[model samples]
Target: MKVVSRIINVVLVIVVLCSLVAAIGSAITKEPMLLTVIRSNSMHPVWERGDMVIIENLKEEKTIHKEDIIFFKTEEGSLSKQGWIAHRVMSGSREEGFITKGDANKYTDQSSDGTVPIKQEWVAGKAITIGETPIVIPKIGYLSLWAEKFQSNPLLIPVIALVLAGLIAFGEIKFTKKRKKKSQGMELQLIYIVGGLTIAVIMGGTMLTSGQNLGLAYQVSDKSQGVIMGSDVGILKVGDKVSRPLSELSNNGAFPLIGTINTSDKQIELSHERVILSKGEQIKSTYTVKAEIPGKYESSIRVGLFYPFLPASLIYFLSEQSYWLALVSVSLVPGLPLMVYPFVNGKMRRKTAKLLRRKKRKIQSSLPF
Candidate 1:
């Protein structure tokens, strides 16, 4: 039982460490081509929905060739609206951009017109395929796809975290009891350790939930005059501000627009009101969004939660320094006393034993010596 518990604990620790590493690595890379799960069957028979695929960004446009499978930024107003697409390179050259087509599709993405080709700048990455076979890990992406459906509901995260904490604490209690039946005093100490760890986990999970619910960051691509992306659950309360780098445009035609601010649960204000952004080369602005209601709401262009959903949340939680620091603080507050009590109690016991021995010696010496 002890060995098994130790192993389980070790595995959990390793998972947490790996999550932190992955999150940091992804941030440093600046590209989203780390690991993404397929949500569509556009590249069917080869890679299906719920299949996990690793993406590596193509460094140079010259390396791209016909027949290679590549992932690129999706055009606006597409059915999926996922911002990215993966397809086979049907035809093109470096100078004349590329026209990609899904293997299962009848025509190209542009549907045979071929007038508007995917620019070299738009290509994100090329799928690493072995010969004609695309290497894929099957059925693992279901978690991601399922999470996307509930991605709007941020509250689910804390609820899940609380449940996990309770379950873990219960398991630890049982395991400690079964392992240390003789050491009754150590039971409470073990609980302290277990409870502290559990609380830390819950805190980390809650941090992730809050970030997903409240905070967002996005970059305006050079190709796009304007773009909006976000979840419906994301609410910007009245007086809340969204700050981002604004692109400078010669004309007022391409100014930033925030649309569809919900007034009530049913009614919405279609806001096409243009706000003047700071001028010069690097135009940056923080638009203090107006909300009809004083509570949580969603914007038209909400941020998206990334792939491998739950794991992403965990990783994201660990990525921040504040969460880790808070975890340490919270864990140590209860854990320190529990850990020190055992040693402190041992010293007290030894002192008491020593005093008893001295008392015995004094009594003997006084009696008949």
Candidate 2:
């Protein structure tokens, strides 16, 4: 019984440490190093909704080949809204671009105006697999999906932390009763655990509340003058331009953040490409859409939230290059300090204490009292 309990405790501690590492790594790299929940049945037999899969970022594995399952961003003019999709590579090459298809779909994503050939720059990451089989944790992702719905709530992280702390305290009470002499060590362990949890909560909360996709659906026709029916959807004629306010962007987290607005389409223009917000701040901005061609169009605006520790010039340059890179750089502001603290502070304190003890012993011996 005691051995089984020990094993369980070890497993729980390892899980907590790994969770902290993953949260910090994703923040610093701007690439997800944790499990992503499957949201659809497109992969069906391989893995379906509610299953979780791990991915390796494209930066780590630049060479993609046929039959590899990759996660990529959907093109602006594609049938589906601009978002991420995970599919298997069917054919094509780096120069020509690759063809992708869902495992259960009859046609390629490029077929019938679904999407253009998959560009190299569009790929985000590839699903991790072992010998043609993906590592899947079944049904566990439902918890994550459920948690996502409450991400906007400011109290969510605090509520969760409180619950976890209560559980830990209860366990400690039982353990201390059986081993009173080890109470001090257990208290130290509890402090470390709580501190790690706090960091993880802050990182997770910031990432979750930072960004969202805002889209505009409109039509261009030669017969009528341009008119915006609502904030997002509208009608326009060739050479016409219409502007409207986008949904308000809010910073619900406890810290200040930099929000950058970006678009893949040339016809769309934002009044403010970047805005900085303090805690609980909200801002509304407008975007103009130009009609160059006669057709229905959908434009997606990507808002990425980043920590504001980097220089404004550097942040602007990096944001222009890639939002992910800017995010990665900003994340290091907090992550690097946390990572270096233990090694620097703990070692220095230990060495200082040792020197002080040695000097005291020499002084006592010389006095011969």
Candidate 3:
């Protein structure tokens, strides 16, 4: 019984440490780690609300076979408030993208106005599986979902921090009174404090630096005259093609990013399909829209941004072959360091402590006593 209890305690500690590492890594790297919560019954029998899904980052291995379940960012104005959706690929190709539908849903997502076919650039990751079955922890994500609400409240964080600090101080005082000896308790406390700060920073930063939804609104008029107005708002007659400069895309972040521009309609042609931008650089390209059957039509250009961890040329080439491949390759950069650092750091610390103790013993033995 004691051994079983000890094993459970060890497991819990490891889980807590891993969660802290993921939180801090995500904040520093501006990328998501491998876990996500299922918020609805869309997945139904396979995965329901309050279940935790383990995601395999597609940035390294970008192959998406038919029937593979993928996690992707939803298009602008989607019904989901979380801005992401996970669904199974029903059918499609890499060049044209894939059609996706939830297991419990009656129709494909593209049947609605808000979601289009699942594009490669929009895909973040896929569900990790074992021979056709996805791995999920049932009902464990309820706590996470409950805590998620507090993320939006700015004042709550500081209050929570103060309460935690007070509690830690009280515990330390009591422990000191009970036993007056130096131990590793201080180090563990420091780790806990740092972990809390990491969670706070990640939650706050993501809320502030969230992605912007930029789109174009055009009116396809029936008038015989073709009078092209503004870039965002334009009026075009049937069978006429007009070119207009699109909104400038700027990279203010520290890393270099590759942006792929995609349009809703087939008639829209961009001057540049893919663009690379370094820090503090910006680019503006023109898009030519060829009006077909005239009516009040709305068209949107979705730009997918990717951090170019690999060589820009390689990323470009991979994107041409498969956008999913390019995305998967670059995403490995942030997560690799986070996963490897804990073990490496622990090993180094152990070695250093052993050396210090050996040196101390040598000094004591050589002393004239």
Best by lDDT: 2
Q: Residue 212 CA error for candidate 2 (Å)?
A: 9.9
Please, what are the lDDT tens digits per residue for candidate 1 over residues 1-369?
979999998866654443333333333343445566676898887799777676677776448889988878745335235556788998898888787888888878866432367778777787777886776767666654554432244345445545654665586667755765444443455554555554444333322322221233223222322233653223443433333322222212122211111112222322311222222222222223433345333332211122122233342343233333433443243234434553467754564466669778989999864
- lDDT tens digits, residue span 191-278, model 3: 4445455444433332322222245556676776544454444666787877888657666655566776666577788887778777
Predicted candidate 1, C-alpha RMSD = 15.7
Best by TM-score: 2
Q: Count clashes in each candidate, considering only residues at least 3 apart in sequence or on different chains.
A: 8, 0, 4
User: Which residue pairs show backbone clashes in model 2?
Assistant: none
Off by over 4 Å in 3: 1-32, 59-61, 76-82, 138-144, 177-369
CA error at residue 254 for candidate 1, angstroms? 35
Q: Of the pair 1 and 2, which is ahead by lDDT?
A: 2
Roughly what TM-score does model 2 have, to 2 decimal places? Answer: 0.54
**lDDT-based ranking:** 2, 3, 1
In terms of TM-score, how similar is model 1 to the real structure?
Answer: 0.48
TM-score for each predicted model, relative to the true structure: 0.48, 0.54, 0.49
